[model samples]
Target: MCNEMTTSLKTEVLESPLEIVLKGSNTKFITAFKELLLHPVYSRPTLQFIESSVKLAPNRARVLAESEHGRLIFIQLLKQTESWYSGEDNFYLHLLNSIISQLLSADLGNLFLSTFSEPIVNEDERLSLLKIVDAAIDSLLERKSTTLDCQPLLEILFRDFTTASAQAIPFIRSADTSPEYSDSLLSQLTNIWNRLIVLLDIYQTILDNQPSLKPEILKDNIIEELVSLLGEAQKSLPRRSKLADLEKSASKSSSGNVSDHDDLDPKDFPLIKGKIIYLLGTLVQENKQVQDLVRQLQGLELVLTNCIIDLNNPFIRERSILCLRYLLANNPENQDFVAKMEAKETVSEDALHEAGYETELVNGKLALKKRT
Candidate 1:
């Protein structure tokens, strides 16, 4: 009798309306799922429910597999497990974390991974999701209530970084092939790159918490790719328009004083040789490679200092100077290198050279040759 009843229930559950609801498109399902997810009881038990549902409704699993709801549930469950790890003893924490890790590892986080890899997704949709994921990852990383036993989760994110960076080259090259598509693709690519940096920052936080989980492979290759991608994106920017927009934006805010060159169009931004140094200075000052590479890019430093010194805008000059100071200050090993570069360029020289003249030399000190 018990076996008969179990079979009956399974049949009924398989034919249920909820299972039917899961068959629809991902956007619709996520909309409905969000209500359930926000409710305390439903949200907390989501993982257990999902696991069981997948077993009973294999078809529903595929639909869920493609849905935002699925990724949301997975991320939420991982975070909740992190919370449980703090209060639970090592034995149970290890066991639970292991289970969560296995689930994410089985397919290398296929559900979350699939969302970005969707061939049908437009660049606009991709950009929107990237922003959403960035915020979600940031919130997850900031959760102090949770223990950081999430190596599997971090690995999944690392995999994402790898795939995104690989696809970027093709997208960038093809972007120009279609102007309308290129604009949207460029916007999407920028968002992806920005969010990856944000995600990398979170990944670094996890390593700080659980130092043993740092992947040497990622450190060696993935980081270099990330920096290279950022440099490439900066180069692709419409410099004149972007700088004009940046100046206008900067002026509205109280971050610093306005530049005399602030009113100057973006086309005038100095280009050195074949390299675009536009935001390389910003990246050097901001990225973790600060001590490692930014300090070493003293030619970049010279370029930035000269650009700022001649600019009419006080704000732009101050920002560039501040960045230079940071690159020099961050690494002890690079300090001597910075000092040597500074000493050599301390004297003002002729403006006849392409990079502009050092207009003033005071007591053997180099200064931007004032534009007469």
Candidate 2:
């Protein structure tokens, strides 16, 4: 009798619409959202759902922010538990992470961020939110997923970043901001910072492994997409700063205004700064292959160096310093330009602020000597 009852219940449940979709749906998207809200026992179905959703959405997935249905699905997914592992769920996690990133693209970022409320109730919730933010940064660099449509996503993400950064500031400088989460709120903030750094490192992987990307089309797409992604960071700055820097980078890049470089103003756009530095660093690694696009590349370097001097954040300054170090070390073509910028005090004297500065100096001098 017990066996019969269990079999009957299973039969009825199997007949349910949701279950039918789970079995028949090619994209498995139905279960993807459900898995987020359901138990980890449903991991297999959730993986199927993510695979299908990514297939349907691909690089241009409409961020759930604009689509009411999609938003509902996203909400469900955020409610998931640790049943999904770094092992079994890695594929789905990567896919979900990628989709969230697309959702946070510049065009859709604001909408996504705006949909969430301030002061999440717990660290777990904040960590989930942080995942999406991290994913956006990853998507920006990974697939070069920048489009005019992503601008809104980028805006909201920056707002999220600034707010998160604000929260993190106190903890970053605090004495007790250790790993002691047993009775501290700041510990949560520390977790957020650690997670963000991990995400940035993942994002940085795109530039670090740029040489491994296949197909010339994908490579080209990445370059332009990253450029657009950085462009959105301009919106986060003061209006006057934005407009002034806009006019300046434009004029400087166009007129080759080497003498009066200050004729153009600079903006404190951190995202842009990070993106530019990442791009320059990546390009430096493959400088020889990009000779055909030398003019545009030069313009990009000019803008980057100009922005590097204008950046106030030490982290950003460090990144820019590292990028310059790479270019000056591996790409001898940039030596004269670096010398010129150094002469003009556009790059700081404290090269130690950048990573690998000594190695860069040694390699740069070697490259210069070889040329001589």
Candidate 3:
């Protein structure tokens, strides 16, 4: 009778939906599964079983992602786990590490990307997902051993995010008339931009802690696309008159609320542009190939132009200048490029001087000559 009951229970669990098992409370199976998840032994078979289940039922994994309880449980486990080197108390960390590896193997990471690509109805929930994904990335990056495989996850993240951002650019450029419509578009753009920032943060952390990961990041064409996006963003900044019109409309509104026009703030454009410049700077700071690529793409000109235009904003100007310095640093081709640009400017000024006008370098600086 005892053997028969055990077999029946096992059969019942096998037949039940995966999400129910994951999200259900206090059942014998859930308690057992939770133990397996937090198991101290890194090579336990039960852990493998759970991983296989997720792999086999990736749609169920998406279901878990959609559930607040499921997400919180997973995040809590990750938070409680110390580093892998934390001796005997590192069970949760070990389990999470394995779980991430399994998720990648099962192609569930692609499912996560697909879910992320969908329209986010809840901003807080979307942020929670971002945090969970970032945590998984952090866990992989924390490994001291060389065996961890983070490339696949990184690739999916980069490809999906860039593609999504590219898709959003057109809607942003359109700048729809309805305040509600415009706000929605800007919110989408902001969410995508924030997600990109999170990814870039992970990349920077990897580069800082594990220099070997830099090549994998660079080879993905992420930087090239980011530079292109930055140029487009700069070109799309709202004109001063358009901003004034928005201000006038805001002032005339009965509710006396300018919240609708918050997304149209001219300053936000420069801030986003500055961050892109900083990202480019970070990418090229230690990578010669990226430096060459930036030069080949005429990124130097773009950075310089933006720097000049936003000189009044110290942060924007500083970031742009730093990016230019990185792109040209020890780069002979880029140096020559800058030198030619300066030479052309000099020739133009000399031509004016030759036309019977006095030109002078005040304090060794080029200054326009006044007709005297």
Sorted by lDDT (best first), the order is: 3, 2, 1
Number of backbone collisions per candidate, in order?
A: 14, 20, 0
Clashing pairs in 3: none
Which runs of model 3 end up more than 4 angstroms from their true locations? 1-20, 23-127, 135-149, 175-183, 238-270, 308-314, 344-372
Prediction RMSDs, each to the true structure: 12.7, 15.5, 12.1
Task: Please state the error at residue 297 of candidate 3 in Å.
Answer: 1.6
lDDT of 1 by residue, 157-250 (tens): 6665666566565544443343344565556655554444444544545554554654432454543544465444344422333476656656
lDDT per model vs. reference: 0.43, 0.45, 0.56
Positional deviation of 36 in candidate 3, in angstroms? 23
- Residue-level lDDT of model 2, residues 1-372, one tens digit each, is 333333432454334433333343333343334533364444445445544554455433343444444554555555452233334646556656655654544245455556644442244544565565655565555555453233333334334445544554444344222334344564565455544443344345543544443233234334443443333333343222455655666676688764432332222222334544555456655454442233243543443443343422324455656555555555545655555555555655455244343213453442122221
Using TM-score, give the best candidate's number.
3
Question: lDDT per residue, candidate 3, 1-372, as tens digits?
Answer: 333334443576556666776676635654454554455542244444445567566456655456654554454344333333345745444555556555644456655554444353244344435545666666655766524455556777676557656765674455433234466666666655556556656565656566676677777887788778776765665433345654565475656664433534432332456667777888888567788888787677777665533421236656666676676666666655655555456233332333223345557644333346
All candidates' TM-scores? 0.42, 0.41, 0.53
